[model samples]
Target: MVASCATCQQKAQQVKAMQTNIDFWPTTLKLKNSSDLICDESLRYLAGKRLVCRGRWQQRTVAVKLFFHPKSAKRHWLREKQGVESLISNQLSTPSLLFAGTLIDGTPVLIFDYLSSAKTALDVWKELDNDEARLDLLQQIVVEISAQHRCGLWQQDLHLGNFLISDNQIYTIDGDGIKSSTDGKELTTKKRRNNLALLLAQLSPNYDHLATPAIEHYAATSQKNMRDLKSITEKELPHIRTTRRHKYVKKAYRNCSEFIRHNSLRQVAIYRRDADAGLIKQFLNNPDQLITDGTILKNGNSATVAQVTIAGDSLAIKRYNIKGIWHILKRCWRPTRAWISWGNAHRLTISGIDTPQPIAILEKRLGPLRTSSYYLCVHENTPSATDYF
Candidate 1:
């Protein structure tokens, strides 16, 4: 098998290390085009490889994209540049690029006029409390998307977040996803279906019934008969779900956008990336003792659950007991119930099904095999359905 060169290996490690640092706060950078710019807090961070921040450049408020991915940084930057240029050429409403420059550290960055009053379509989605308001928002989004499709351009990352709304005017962002046809023709029906399905599959299942109406809006905007696209879109959804589920399940076990992991021969522990490290360390030292001090919800031989307060956060921690010799042998070779619960909680969370926020999962393992485990989640205070009703 061919092996990567040492330089490639070092760069890969650096990229991996950067992904773990989520607090990549805005900072000042010396640019090649204008002058040194100071960035404010980040606008959005995606998968740790790309960052969007708004800051002042050349005495104007500007939005910036800093590409830090070692392998795809330059390529994605070029694609983004091309996409923005294509949108402008097609007369699409989008932020005009002020300058494309490289940082002193050789990071590729794009600077644009910051839309001060604008909010992402995803943010707008959150405020639409009624079905009519939501469908209107979806119509606006698909209309803009329809315009892009008509111009032989499509966003690969075709999600609500890529569009921005300002004064009722919608503008597209994230040019890296701009895809174009070879012959500059409109996207085919199947291509449109898949792209639409990508967005649909990611939507919270609360909107499952809205998918057909959404397509109707898209069809009306496109001015075509697209009754078949609905079926095609539905057919494409499972693939996206399977892919997303597999990717998210992997992230739950490692130091990624959402969770952090600590590996050792004795045990493997994963905690929420935003969780307090000190509190986790304290809880790790003696979880049983910590539970003893809290209000016990269920004190059973097989499992114990308690309402514990740690570092000012109300948390519920469940400890899966070993029970007996047979139980110990069975669980030792596989994931404890605590481990499964942790995974399921996160799965529900990412699917947008409401569940308690999972804070940590501890697997007490002997080398590779596992024994008893503990699961920690934020203690929610919402009333039960029966009581609320």
Candidate 2:
């Protein structure tokens, strides 16, 4: 027994030393393009605001996520690394982090063991034709959540996309979404129910029939009474919907590629789709010209809306007209109308409500006070609420 204990201690020390080595490993791999990758068989599998490539590393298949934004890359990489390390220490099932480092241009790169045959819960749900299979999957997800709860960890952003299934085993991904209790106590009743509700919210309204059985299974696995669980879930349903609505909206805003520029001339805010400074300046300088050349949608007292196609993309530009000198003074202390509307549009969109996608908000200010503002958004052909009424 003494020899075995000594061996374990020696192994632990070796592991600690190895980790320290890896943490300071020089990060010499500067990934400029996919061509620079060592693995020739690598294919560009996923491309979003960032890039995800599936390739072989160290004789094993791996997934590499490369961040485009330096700041975001550093922040998310650190959070995910911390979460994965915590899960590993607790002996929880998750992907093994093979490597994490920054490239020459300071872009963060994270490599993890790839589950080649795995499918996200969202993907499986679309393929599932029968209700039984769907229910089974939900049960599996609940069991996994219960296990995590028992470990005093809860995923703050629970959704179908975060859960992956392979070989009949469900594995949780998106380590940045995972949260743990610091007090070494079990999750509170409210926290557990909220987490469960978040999972349920991802399902379609038609799948309401599966809620009862799923909840029952979760309660049984968590060793909680079905009646009490049902009561808490019932009371929390409305609040859950509201919370999820806002959460999704915030997520949408974060996902958008946007930037703000300030100079001696004017303040400009631009989104990914409207990075053309010339086009934005044209709309800001010549609103009247656009009204005459472009399609006028609305001519209101306080605002004028026009649809203009710039570079083959249709956009709606709303010019907030200063009603008079009195109106300008009243709004001087507040943010520009364009800024307010841009934020409100995002709020409406994420709340499961319908609204045009806000692309950009530009304000031409004279010193500290605002002089003119313009809100640009994607042109949606949907009818107004008043028309239906």
**Highest-TM-score candidate:** 1
Point out where model 2 deviates above 4 Å.
Answer: 1-56, 59-61, 65-79, 86-93, 100-109, 116-140, 165-169, 181-188, 198-213, 234-265, 268-292, 384-389
- Pairs of residues at least 3 apart in sequence or in different chains that clash in candidate 1: none
Q: What are the lDDT figures for the candidates, one per model?
A: 0.80, 0.70
- Model 1 C-alpha RMSD vs. true structure (Å) is 4.0
What TM-scores do the predictions have? 0.84, 0.67
Candidate 2 lDDT, 1-389, residue by residue in tens: 78755543453343234223435222223454432333323223221224455666666777776554422556777877777776677677787888877554445677888898988888998899999999998999999888888888888778888888888878888787778899856687778888888888766656768988999999999998777679644667657867777765454334332433433345545343435666767765675676667898889998899999888878898888898889988886678888678768866754546677776666776666776688888898877779988
**Which number leads on lDDT?**
1
- Clashes per prediction? 0, 0
Alpha-carbon shift of residue 143 in model 1 (angstroms): 0.3
Residues 216-278 of candidate 1 have per-residue lDDT tens digits of: 999988986877676844588778766776777777877776667889988888897678978
For candidate 1, the per-residue lDDT at 85 reads 97
Off by over 4 Å in 1: 1-26, 46-48, 232-234, 276-278, 284-286, 324-326, 381-389
